[model samples]
Target chain A: MIERLKDLWAHRELLWNMTVKELKVKYKRSVLGFAWSFMTPLVMLLVFSIVFSILARGGDVQWYAVFLMSGLLPWLFFVNSLMQSVGSIVANPGLVKKVYFPREILPIAAVGANIFHFVLQMLVFFVFMLLIRWHFSPWLLLMPFILILQVVLTLGLALLVSAANVYLRDVQHFVEVALTALFWLSPIVYPVGLVASQFPKFMPLYLVNPMTNIVLLWEYAIYNPHHYGPQVAYISFWGILITVVFSIVTLVGGYYVFARIERGFAEQI
Target chain B: MEHAVEVREVSKMFKLYHENVRSLKEKVLFFRKRGYEEFWALRDIDLDVEKGETLGIIGANGSGKSTLLKCMTRIIYPTSGKIMTDGSIAALLELGAGFQPDLTGRENVYLNASILGFSRKEVDGKFDEIVAFAELERFIDNYVRNYSSGMYIRLGFAVAISVDPEILIVDEVLAVGDEAFQRKCLDKIDEFRDSGKTIIFVTHNVDVTREICDRVIMLEEGRIVRDGIPKEVVNHYHQVMETEEEASEQGNRKIEITEVRLLNDRGEETNDFYTGSSMKVRVCYEAREPIVDPVFGFSLDDYRGFTAFGTNTALKGLEMGTVAGDGVVEFDLKSLPMLEGRYLVSVAAHSRDEQTVYHWQDKLYQFEMKSDIDDVGLLYIPCEVKTGPQAG
Candidate 1:
């Protein structure tokens, strides 16, 4: 583990280059380019607001657009990274076969690119809040830590999927199906309180889902600043801990699997 | 003296999975996992090279040359055995494998060089030299996707040689660059050889192996068949090639080779020919029915299967016509331009469309280069060089 860390540290320049190159290629030749990053979340929030408001028919729920944006922001970053990283190895089979670096770099490139988009969308999120009557508080200082958690969690899953893709090309399809199921399972569209009222087991289920903690942390920081207290801190800490453990396990396993079959990749690919 | 590398009975086995499980049910049940068959790519390979020695590995395709190089570089773990090496190793296995096409050439230099273990400070010091070597100073800022194939190799090779590695492992990387670039790379390799770095060179060109290596190791299938001086190992490799060809002829495939010959101007069989010598090659076929077109191509390949000179009768607008019972067909070469080496002649018979292959033969006849000392490369291109200050 330490050796891998040392290698990553030694090759820090490569990581930076990979991230920058990823962002460039993604936005290149597009009509709107990076603006589309902010536009996507805004559009999704507007549609969800209109649909949810009609479905509720004048409920006690306040600021429906803000509520939906909180979940939409983190969900978009996580799901987009998960979907793209599944083919990270198979798509760049030439790079994998020819070079010997941390194979994790391939998946991490996607995560980094998605994180860039997520940050752009966050700027739009703040713009919407300023347009309304909400106040930006001291809790906004912790947004960077919350964003790091989302990155770690998403990258950990990306590593596992990219490695599994070498043996099972169907992991790409499996991830799409799995993400659809996970979308409703998480407290994205609705609050945990609403789900807990009917199914009392939703609290444990929510805590088990790493994104639940991540999304709630985002909500506390962005929408409900007063709610940022010891409970949110405790959840963020555990989210970070889980992310670290998961990322390390996947990184090591992926590296070993990659090195084991590294020779045959040239012949097979 | 300390040894630079030690390989004790190192072998690599690959488990080839032909039918990959695609569905969730099959993958969960592990149904298709049992179909994998294990094949040893390298077996009981043992050798050692002292510091500053250049060891060349020569073998046929699928003979484990690249596998052995990979194991030595620790790019791939061996299935069995162990390797002990000293110092930091840099392996230039594939050209531009570490490069990102979407990234600029300048960015790729730092990215790929750092991946190979050089620091930003180190690369910065040699940045100008590397660009000068590749002759891409103008395109440095442009993304690598815009670079041509030659430009890519030039930059890739430049980064590889610029790093002062203690041990450098190369595999056919020199085969792609242009003549000038290849000369520059060879000079750099020579500099590395002069320094005390252990170099393991892998190539299918026997002449390259003989020119650059202090020792040569020959591998057949997965076993080390011969190891010693380059000339001795190459002779053994040629002898084995002959035996293997004879063995394959007796196999289940029934399209047999009856006779092969090369004729002179008067149509008499001769073993000697010179550069620019107009020669006739006759190949006798013994099939019950006529083989149309038959491709009837022959290539003068060096001992390592690197083709030196090759052309087909169909390609030269000479149709072999039709042949029934037993027959002989001739290919008249207008000019044979090849230098000194033990070159093998390979022939193949395909359909008129050249899509479906009917029969193929390699190393059917071997010839020697009898050209002048000034001749070079796979083919001898006549040229005159006047030195002593270019007419100033």
Candidate 2:
């Protein structure tokens, strides 16, 4: 592990350049290139706000539009990173078969590119919140900490899927179906409180889902339902510990599986 | 002496899959079936390249030459054993292996340099030199997708060579681009040799290996068959390849070789000749059926399978039209300029274009030449020495 880390460090510039390449290629030859990054979340925000307003017929939650944006933006970051990274290795067989620096660079660069887009979208969304004169809790300072957790978790899963995709291409298609199911399972469209209250008997089982815990932390930090909606339990001490432990475990385990299988990658491809 | 690269008991095995089983359904369907054949690409290969030495690897196709190179470069791991290198390595397994099409040439230069583990600061120092070397100064700012194939390859070669790695592993990349660029790359490699860095090169171009390599290894199948000085190992390679080729004889048999003989100036059949002496090659053929416009030719080749001389009656404007029975054709040579060596002769009878071979005996006849003249080379040249002062 130390040797691998040293090699990764020595080739840090390569990692940086590859990440930049991914970001640049994603935006090239399009008139409204980088703008497309935020458009997905904003469009989803618009459609969901209107649709949920009609479905609830006067929901009691205050500043619900801002509430959805906070959870939805970070959700896009996690989801898009996984989607792009799953096929990263198989897409660039030229780099994998012909050159050797660190094989992990391919998937890591894909995640890195999504990270840039995610940050850009978040900055724009946060500035728009300030312009709306919306009040944010002091807990919003933990947004970066929550983001780091999400990144580690996403990168871990990304590494696992990308390496598995090289051996069994069905893994990429499988990831698409799995992400759709996972999206609804997470509290992106609704609050964790609704799930906790509706299925009070299974609330522990629901918290076991890492994203449920993670999205609740995002709500706790940026949404801060304690300030907006008094009935909601936005902050949970157990949720923070679970999110932190789950993120680290996934990262370490995902990277371990990825490294073990990568030796067969050139031949498999 | 310090070794730059050491490969110890390294062997690589690859599974040749009968059917690709990527999907879950296919994997389940083939779960009980044997799905692949095990093929060993390299076998217990042990070699150490001394620092500052230029080593050459030569082999036929599918002989694991490229596999060994990929192993040394860490592009693929060996199935057994390990390869350790003392210094940083830059491998040109394929020119422009990772150049992104959307990126500009300047961006790709730094990008490709980074892929080979060179720092941006290092690339910054040699960036202009790379563009100049590739002759892409005008297209450096343009996207690589728009560059011509030759231009793209040139830029790849330029960036790879400019890295100036401690241990350079090159595989057939020198054969790329036009002749002039090849010459320049070779010259630059020669300069690298002078600077005392290690180089491991794999190429089918034996002549170039003879010129540049301090040591050469020849691979056959998955094993190294010969390793020595370049000249000796290359000769062994020629011998191995020539002997591997089966001697074949196929023809319509309208006119087939019944007998062949080599005679001296006095018209006596012999298998020995002296340099500068007259000789005759006689081919006797029996025509089982009437054949028209038949040509016969013979080539004298050294033991290394290099053809030294060859000619045919078709080229000499001699045509045998509709021959019926046995006949003799004599190739009369006034003098032989061959130096001292054992030579083999291949005689053939065919149509005018030599396409429809009536019969071909590939290196089936042998002879020896003796030369007392003080000279060295494939041919014995007549000379007269003159001693003179520095006056006009």
Highest TM-score against the true fold, candidate: 2
Residue-by-residue lDDT tens digits, candidate 2, B33-106? 94689899999999999999999999999999999999998889999998999998999998998998999999
Candidate 1 regions exceeding 4 Å error are A131-133, A141-145, A198-203, A225-269, B26-33, B242-392
* Docking quality category of candidate 2 according to DockQ thresholds: medium
TM-scores of all candidate predictions against the true structure: 0.72, 0.84
- For candidate 1, list the clashing residue pairs, or say none: none
Error of 2 at B291 (Å): 20
Candidate 2 residue runs with Cα over 4 Å from true position: A231-234, B238-246, B250-300, B303-360, B364-376, B379-392
Name the lDDT value of residue A85 in candidate 2: 92
- Model 1, range B1-392, lDDT digits (tens) per residue? 26889988998888777675556777778764557879999888888888888888888899999888878776667888998899888889887776877778998898778777777888999999999999999999998999999999999999988988999999999999778888888888988998868899988777777887889999888888888889668766775665366422221112234777887667778766776677777777665566555556777766666766678767788766665566666677877776655666776666668776655765757665566656557677768877696675
- Candidate 2 lDDT by residue in tens digits, A179-198: 88888988778777777778
In Å, residue B129's CA in model 1 sits off its true spot by 2.0
How good is model 1 by TM-score?
0.72
